[model samples]
Target: MYPKVGSPKKVTMKWLDKAFAPLKDYLDAHHPENAKAIMGWMTYKGNFDDLYCYENRMTQGYIEFDRSGQLIRCSDNALDHEYELGYERIPVKTESIHPNVDRWIDRTVSAKKADIFREELRLFLQHVWGPMANYDFSDLKANYPLQGSGSPYCLYVYPSRFSKMIAFQFVGDEIVEKNCSLREYQKFEKSEREFMYQGWHLVTLIREFLAFEPDLSTTREVVRKGCEWADMRIDENTEFVLTAEARRMLEELEKEESKK
Candidate 1:
């Protein structure tokens, strides 16, 4: 499905070596078999890729590559590993043809910041939702705030499941918002809650902190002690007040009843 490998060109061993450097390092460390098995595909007569794409997910090659140089043609289901069956496996390029005019930024992350995204988010959630709360973030999706599509985790309470205490269907016109350090009853109508933009604002702050430093001091007052996601709704036309203290009392009462 790539543009017919329309205009293929050759790339140097140096360029190829540079482009795949990170993968080479990883494969060198971990994947000895795949490191040896991977092959370079070329168009007929020693030409490298002209245009490219990869994955049915279609996440890469979204925009046009440099139209003037070496590229790869990526077909649908390229992950299936069948594209090379009929293509020519040419020898590696020996000469540099065109100068890489644009500035090439290295995409490698420093070892200190590597692979800490999910862990940092987990810490943030635990600080807000309490140590006992259970959450499922397997479907969690996030984007840079105010820039891209915005993270889905910041849009809805469902796709990324918080425990039942914080995530549930609104059944009535009003719910008591409790344990958020309010001196009096805090009521939020369903319509008002819909517009609260609760998740959006929360995610924006988290994103800003992540992009700069991991310091979460700005959010210290908002989400501590299960307040961020805890809102008890009215039940059977009656207001339910289940603050953290009330839940603790209920637990003690249950234990006493069990003993009796």
Candidate 2:
């Protein structure tokens, strides 16, 4: 026979008094309007570890409001602090170095991964050349035909805006090479060789122009796609070279997708 199961018991405000009195007193003294609006309370139990495990900890508390409303505040009992209800803005002064660019450059320099660095450069070029080179967006066309012969590079052309074509030579959806050379559909070559050579790494090319560009929608999309493609190729033995911040951003993108 199955063991007897008890019906759930509803918790009342009186029960909450033992635990939330300090929080109540705080709100009563400071934000009385918020205090008066409280209708019910809830608690969360979880485990926390710091070198060792601590179980059955009351990790959080919440207050609910009436009129089909709620104002929730979670407490970190261990830290003795409440989470902020609203957002705060902290101003940072603009710097010459882009965070991603700096991190990528540092990693590349330290790892000495010249081939991976070059591949990243080609990917960056495929994305930002249109905007950085000031191509007319309205005249731009997606997935232009292949242009070159011996190397056979695919072109993402923006004709009538300029004579130069940004050639992205690919190897099975992965961009293997890129260049700004004139094609049969174009007239003159735009000299972007200095942009490529002056930089110690691929990030310098991006930091020079793309970072300051007003319209970076295309660049953002292309970079995200490139990263996704790279992620698919990663295995246990593969050393993923993206910086911590970049990995965090990618994780956030994954979280957003999961929510959807």
Candidate 3:
């Protein structure tokens, strides 16, 4: 719940405007009804009488104007309308900064990177586990490489329907250690093959890094396959082996990923 009216805090119109600006044309074109409705409602007063008063109403005492601007004994319809319009205008801000913020940086991906990798992973999952977990592939599209969290490469893997969270972090550009709770895993019955395939797929994906450096000549080789980062644990279980070139690429990827 938001703070009550007159709570002595300012609503960030600038931030909200910036965040929601990108959606303006989109909203206007696709959702003109909502756009027109909000525009029409903006003319009315709202519950917060002080904020949404008419230009003339400013001369009158702030409280004198009902939220709706019409001077009834207990009417602030303008303010109420402003509140509603303000709420509707919110999405303009959220859609703007979302892309540059790397919201989709490290979410999920297609099963096919290379034919071999895809086939191998599919087989590994299908054969290894008797009952593979189901998931929404679209979630992969939202893979955000979040900072100040566990591991450099945080992946949202679904080990089971009930045990969906299997956050994995990279250890030294190689190993991808999982962040599953022992209790959660114990509660769910998974085949040995499922566990092995998950581990193998992660390693294989990491090892396939290319050099992603700005200047390919001076820095180590860079790979631009996938990018996301999290504050992952570095431990024995988190290590994987890569080609010397791939290792160099991954180390650089880690540094670049951190900057984002």
Q: Which digits, one per residue and each the tens of the lDDT, describe model 3 over residues 1-260?
A: 12123211222455334322323333376557666443332221233533332211222222223333333332333222223222221111122222211222223332322222332223222222212223223333222222222222222232222212233211222122212232323222232234343432222223212122222211111111111221233444555668999989999999999999
True-vs-predicted CA distance for residue 252, candidate 2, Å:
38
- How far does residue 36 in candidate 2 sit from its true spot (Å)? 77
Model 2 scores a C-alpha lDDT of 0.33
Candidate 2 to native Cα RMSD, angstroms: 25.0
| Best model per TM-score | 1
Candidate number with the higher TM-score (1 or 2)? 1
Worst 10 residues of 3 by lDDT: 218-227
Q: Ranking under TM-score, best-scoring first? A: 1, 2, 3
RMSD of 1: 23.9
Q: Give each model's whole-structure lDDT.
A: 0.32, 0.33, 0.30
Provide the lDDT at 130 for model 2.
34
> Per-residue error at 153 for model 1, in Å?
7.6
Give the runs in model 2 whose Cα sits over 4 Å from its true position.
Answer: 1-212, 229-231, 234-260
Clashing pairs in 1: 49-71, 50-71, 51-72
